[model samples]
Target: MDFVLVHGTTQSPAGWDRVAKLLRAAGHRAIAVDLLTPADLPVEGYAQHARDQYDGERPVVVAHSGTGVLLPAIAEALDARAMTWVAAYIPDFSGGRSLRDEVVELFAPEWIGVDPTADPAKASEFLFHDCDPETEHLALDSLRLFSPAVLAAHRAGPAPEIPSTVIVPTRDRTLKPEWMRQAARDRLGVTALEIDAGHCPHMSRPAEIAGILTGHA
Candidate 1:
């Protein structure tokens, strides 16, 4: 099956490199998308950019972190086959809250703002505690700043009606695993699949992440 990987905000498609490599090695096609900044456009535009990258194949869309908010629109656009969330922020549209509001309420105040990438040490500690030093360094160096507008954006419509799975990293320091479980159940109506890794599982545990994507786990 074709898999389109959508990364979280402030992240480049390179974040999915290891997972994509593993998927390709397993004979599955993978497309890691570099999401466009919503900027002045409606937040749905981000989903449109993701859909535009598709070549008409009904793909299993795997979204990581903040990009999970775009799944409903992307799935609506492509009639996606399925979706998987990796340590992602599942939007609660019912609460009438914007993504930025949800994030601010969820994380510590110090973690919010223009860019956490500016502090490589803190970023690495929070995002890559389970990863090796080399991998952590690479991730920190490649980090980018997301536009504030992206955070302020709200979902344009209801959640997509489709088969979905949530992959929760039990060791994630950034997003608590229990919180992910509750959010998945409350918002997405699905029980999360737990992994023994941190927030960036594709970087720390690519083979296992691929296994889940391929339905082998």
Candidate 2:
């Protein structure tokens, strides 16, 4: 399958270097993109950045973190498949509540904290619990504060209406694991597969992530 791995906030496609290799070793073509939500651009720009990179190739799209907000629209454009990783999948894009809905709020506050400084230690402790210090620092250093609109316009925007999968990191501290399960169930209406890993499993647990991808159609 031709797969595009969409990253979350403060991330670059470079993080998937190991995961990409894993996918190829298993005979699948994969590309990880550096979304346009540079630390400078508003969060809204990240969606556009992803939209520009989202092509219907191989018919599969995998999105992580903030990029989840854009997947519904971008995947719609490609008529492709999608897999969301510990991210939001809201619905009702026409200015009201979305056609999709979820109870991600359950895991908020404890696991995920919003600090403006983008502290690497705090972020790593929450997002990349299992990753090494250097890798974790690299990941945190890439983060930037996103627009409130990204979270604000959420329920008011379209949700991805495609065959999809949601990977919930059971050990996730960044976004609550309960939220991940709730998001998967309430939005996609599927039982999420739990993995013993952190927020960026494709980085910390690439081989396991790949196994799930291959296990799917």
Candidate 3:
């Protein structure tokens, strides 16, 4: 499968550098896409960035963190074959169309601590749990903050139904892990898997995440 992985807010595609290497080593097609949103723009704008890159192919859409909200639309717009989300954000919209109140609720407290002027390294601690101090600092160097408005706007729902895989990181600091798992089942009819990693499983346990994808592949 042609797997195109996406990054979340306050992030670029750099986090997938290591995972892409591992995927290639295992003879799998892995492409980490660049969701080029402004440094200070709301992440929902980044969702549109994701939509613009769609090529309407059967590539596996892999979304990490904030981009999950966008990938559903990407999959529908591009007519993707499947999706495998890694600790991704999935919104359960209440009406015909609208961002859930959960948007601001999900990251509010965490957003409060991050100074709008602070860089990625400082933000990583809040999004991920128990990562190497240096690794966290290094990975977060490319971070950016998203506004609540952008995230809400990016809450585009998926087509009637689609096949998807959602991997919930049990120790995740970003979202309630258990709730995310149940969400995969309720929202997207996802074939759910649980990994014992934090928000960035591709970084913390590349092989294991790859293993699950390959198993599905």
Candidate 4:
């Protein structure tokens, strides 16, 4: 099966290198997308970009972190066989507030000017704590800044009708595992598969993550 991996806002396609390698070694196709910037596009536009990049038949769409909000749209556009959320945000629009508002409310003053690309050390501490030295350095060096507008956009649509699974990082320091479990159940209506790693398990535990994706876990 083909797997289309969509990275998070602060990340590039490079982040999926390890996992993609493992997937291919296991005899499956893995395509990682470097999402277009300014990332100001609506969910539909993002989905179109994903569809344009993938030219395979019924690939499974996987999203990580903030990009999870675009999974439903991307899956629908590509006619994906399944969807996977890897330490990703499961959108809930019941609060009648945009994602940006929730982010501002959650992080307050610090979220405004915080740039992961500009501060590799801070990014390492938060996002790549469990990764090896080389992987962590690569992540820091390849970090990219996402448009603030992307955070504010609301996921305004019904959930896609596809088989979905949520992979939760039990050791994640960025997004708590408990929160992810609740979000997976409440929003995605699926029980999460807990893994022993940080936020970026694709980098930290590539073999294990690959196993999960390939139905070995």
- Which one wins on lDDT? 4
Q: What is the lDDT of residue 140 in candidate 1?
A: 73
What TM-score should be assigned to candidate 1?
Answer: 0.90
Q: How high is the CA lDDT of each candidate model?
A: 0.77, 0.63, 0.67, 0.79
The lDDT of model 2 is: 0.63
The CA lDDT at 140 in model 3 is: 66
lDDT of 2 by residue, 86-191 (tens): 3444343443553133324533455444662356666677667787777666556555554344543455444445776778777776666776676677666778
Ranking by TM-score: 4, 1, 3, 2
Question: Candidate 3, which segments miss by more than 4 Å at Cα?
Answer: 37-56, 93-100, 104-124, 146-148, 158-160
- List the candidate numbers ranked by lDDT, top first: 4, 1, 3, 2
- Native-vs-model 4 lDDT? 0.79
**Mind giving the per-residue lDDT tens digits that candidate 1 earns over 61-135?**
888877676767776676788988898888775776767667755554555653557777777777777889888
RMSD of 4: 2.4
Query: By TM-score, how accurate is candidate 4?
Result: 0.90
Runs off by more than 4 Å, candidate 1? 37-39, 108-110
The residue-by-residue lDDT of candidate 3 on 1-217, one tens digit each, is 6777787665667777777787888887777777664463444455456657655457777888766767676565545678777888776643334344564445434644454227544456555455577666656664554434555564454443667888988878766687687778777777579888877787777788888877885
lDDT of 2 at 15: 61
Give the C-alpha miss distance for residue 111 in model 4, angstroms: 6.9
TM-score result, candidate 3: 0.79
Better of 2 and 3 by lDDT: 3
Report the C-alpha displacement of residue 65, candidate 2, in angstroms: 1.8
